[model samples]
Target chain A: MELIAERGYRRTSLAAVAERAGLTQQGLLHHFPTKELLLVAVLEARDRWDLASSAASAAGSWRTGTLAQLVDYNATRPGIVQTYTVLSADSVTEDHPARAFFESRFRAVREAMAAVLRAEFGETLPGGLTPERAAPLLVAVMDGLQLQWLLDPQDVDMPAAFRDFVALLGRGGD
Target chain B: MELIAERGYRRTSLAAVAERAGLTQQGLLHHFPTKELLLVAVLEARDRWDLASSAASAAGSWRTGTLAQLVDYNATRPGIVQTYTVLSADSVTEDHPARAFFESRFRAVREAMAAVLRAEFGETLPGGLTPERAAPLLVAVMDGLQLQWLLDPQDVDMPAAFRDFVALLGRGGD
Candidate 1:
């Protein structure tokens, strides 16, 4: 993941991964036969970490504040955020192996977010948007802030921007 | 730009760019000496197109609606957006050639956006947030929406979502 995050997926070969992990190419191949497979594992591992941490923080349920807390947590780990930003952008192509994973992952995220919004703001949110409609905007803002922050951390305060967004959500219907 | 957008920066060579442009490698390199230089030229060209269009649309000044119009225009050009997405992600590295360009561009964009917001909503916006503080959020949402729309055009309505964000901004102090 670190290799791919630094050089992007296409440039990061399995040999480099083996070298970084201190394993022979054959040894690495034995564990994950292909680069694509290794990528999938890396992605899955990241998701697992997010889930475990979220679970640990919220007792297995994602609250409205969970997303904000997650943003705060993300600020601490530039590597993971960089990896995700690089891979997610790469995955948008039609032939990218991670395309399906991100597509479904977004759908699931939107649904989960909408549920959280619904819990906080009832059926409809501010500006006459349903939770479903508001959910994607929330997701987009977070992802987008990561991109801007990664580019210029001195200017883009990830956590403060996220808190402002949360405040935006809180003031939506009023 | 299309070749890099499709294949990503590291994987794209001068040969592929030359082939796409119907020029020999030497011919292409005559203009852009190295791959990094070529990438920089492509980014600058894209920005030129944007400035040209924006200037043409708003008489050299941007308005609140200009952002939405830009998003709508962006929807018509998936290739450019994809190139930007791919390159921007790749540029997050500390030493990427385009790093300074994006950093400064964001600074300029945020200042310009804050100016627009202040013009439209005065110093303090809804929720008592200043326009300067609000500018990055607007920029973040626009870029974020692009990522989601690029990934799932069928499911994500880029223009509508942007319009919705504008509406959110308008209702900020109401």
Candidate 2:
């Protein structure tokens, strides 16, 4: 991920990644047969890390739940956010390997979040905001907030903005 | 822009841009001194086009205006949006030329939007819902929606979602 950050994904080779990881090229290749595969592994690792961190944080509180923690987590990891932004934009085409990974990652994340929201609000949510609708809106806001933060981190009070947004969601009904 | 879209940006050259634009290599060089300059020009052209198109659509009807139109315009121009997203992410460092372009572009767009929003809403907007705050949120939502739409156009009803959000914004103080 650091290699992809410093040198772009295309420029960062297996040897470079191995050197950065303090492993021999052969050792790295044993794990990831190709650069594309290695990139996927990196993405998967990030997704797993985020999910684990979010889950751990969620376990601690019901009042200040996963949504708040997710916002905080995003605030701290601008690099990962930027990398995802760049890669996702680049991976728009049908055949891009990263596209599938991102698509599934996004779906899983949305579903997980929707489950949390459902658990919190239950039938109290006005008109009963379906997970499908609420999930996408939440994800869209987060993604959008990240872009705003990237453009001007100082200008965007990300956690506060998200907190306000979630508060509105809790009230439900536009 | 098409050349870069077809063959990724780094792989596409000044020669290719010239060929696509129906200009001789010398002719292209006469207009743009370097590949970077050409890329900038492409971005500038897109900016100008978007501004003009948005301005035309936003010309009349101060209140109850069509935010949906704005969303639709962006949805149709995925190429321009992708170009900006890719360049903006790459331009994280202060020294990158595209960084300045994006910063200026964002500022200009936000300011323009604030003016429009103020005109539309007058003083009815709630406390803390100033144009400055609202403008960035609007841009963030637009950007966020675009990312989601690009990933799965079928899943997102861009204009409807935006309208719902805007309606929520209008009903201030939650």
On TM-score, the candidate that comes out on top is 1
lDDT against the true structure, each candidate: 0.80, 0.68
Tens-digit lDDT string for candidate 2 (A1-174) = 777667654466899989988999999999998776787787778876766666554573333256688679768766667666667665664467677776777777677667767767664343345655666667777777776677777777888777766765666532
Predicted structure with the largest DockQ when compared to the true one: 1
**Residue A29 in candidate 2 has what lDDT?**
92
Q: After best superposition, candidate 1 residue B138: deviation in angstroms?
A: 1.3
> What lDDT does candidate 1 reach at residue A55?
62
DockQ of each: 0.51, 0.36
Pairs of colliding residues, candidate 2? none
lDDT of 2 by residue, B71-169 (tens): 777676666566655566566643566766777777787777777677766544443466666666677777776666766777677777777667656
Model 2 misses residue A157 by how many Å? 2.5
Model 1 chain B lowest lDDT segment of ten:
B53-62
Candidate 2: segments with Cα more than 4 A from true spot:
A1-16, A33-37, A55-64, A123-129, A172-174, B1-13, B33-39, B54-66, B93-95, B122-128, B172-174
User: Each candidate: RMSD to true structure?
Assistant: 3.2, 3.9
In model 2, what lDDT does residue A148 have? 66
